[model samples]
Target: MNVLVTVTEGATVDDEFRIDGLAIDDGSLTTDLNEWDEYALETAVRLAEADLVDEVVTVTIGPEDCEGTIRQVLAKGADRAIRVWDDALERSEMLDVGAKTALLAAVVETEEPDLVLTGVQSADEGFMATGVSLAAAVDYGWAAVVNALEVDPDERIARVRRELEGGVEERTEVDLPAVLTIQTGINEPRYASLRGIRMAQRKELAVRSLADLGLEASAVESRLRLRELAEPESESEARVLEGSSEEAAAELATVLREQGVGR
Candidate 1:
């Protein structure tokens, strides 16, 4: 069985950043393979390493600038990469969950992998809804926040442990043709070997537009609009009580009383 992993080029903000109108200024951000998606890709690569799957492929919705990040995953273990981008995607204020789901569903239809893996959420937006939403759109069985996975291609089953609220874990089995949003800490991602890095340069990396994916320009038009983006205003200030432990404790108590925290 082939596995398809959804990946993204997530932005990391500098310690100090500037808000450029409705978003962080590009100059103040650095892009790399998304942390969560790295774990998902690691899971797929491990499955391939264990001979549980035929191929491990990755798909991303990003611009040409993200090819370096895509190659990082390829070097680590994905067999090839598919990147989807178009003028519409570049022009949009933001690709909402629905728009992203539509784009991914089109690729899913074309690829038709038995299993699909995605990070629990993208670091930048943290919508935490794309994987499940894509499953719904594609009519695939899915589980979210999965921390453990065991796949049986012969039986067409995938058993997973989901991380739930209150430190709860739910173990369940999903049928074949399922989507699983993998959680971090499920596995230790391996670094790319020197040989692997060299080999990645020659691997197939296909770029497709919405039209190529059998989608129209409207597929990327977001229903949601981004109106404001800014740093949150600080609500309170912290003061250091400099003294011995006992004196510091006393000062802390006095400050709490002044703020009516212990009333």
Candidate 2:
């Protein structure tokens, strides 16, 4: 199996608020690999190491600064990486998940990977729609919020297990050349070993521009517009109950009912 994992250069939640002017874009804010994306990368690495996959490639669409993130994934055992550079992407203008999917679909088609994987949702946008949109663009079967995957190389089938309501799991099989959006906590992401980091530096990294993909800056459509960004209204302080345990429970239930949180 050959797998492609797409990652994004995302701002931290705080950074998002800061950029929106709810706060300040302080240098203290930290940025790193997205948690859900790490699960996808780790899953690909494990499959490669177990001999179930021949290679794992990581791809990201961002500015030049995103090269650090690509290197981090390469150090974790991806065979190679691809960086799609677009300066306008830095302003977070492509906020529509579908628009981002279109860009990724254009890249994935060129790679010709057997499977494409992405985080179920980005921590920053939390749209949770890219996987399905990308799959639609390429006309592939997609499994969303996948927790596990088993690939049958001979049959070219991928059995995917997904989470359902009430802690249940649903399984479905899709032909190879599919897309999956992986949920967080699917697996433990491996840290880059010293040896692995050294090896990553020598790996082939293909840098492609949007024009190389024959995509114009105006070709992608944005279904969403950010009218304004602001912090969520501050939550009111909680009130403590001054009564017995049973009374406190009753009060809690009353509060829930009043808030329409309980049926």
Clashes of each: 0, 0
Model 2 spans > 4 angstroms off? 14-28, 88-92, 240-263
lDDT of each: 0.94, 0.83
Per-residue lDDT tens digits for candidate 1, residues 156-187, read: 99999999999999999999899999999999
Clash pairs, model 1 backbone: none
What TM value does model 2 have? 0.85
TM-score of 1: 0.91
Q: Using TM-score as the measure, which candidate wins?
A: 1
Q: Model 1 misses residue 203 by how many Å?
A: 0.3
What ranges in model 1 sit over 4 Å off? 240-263
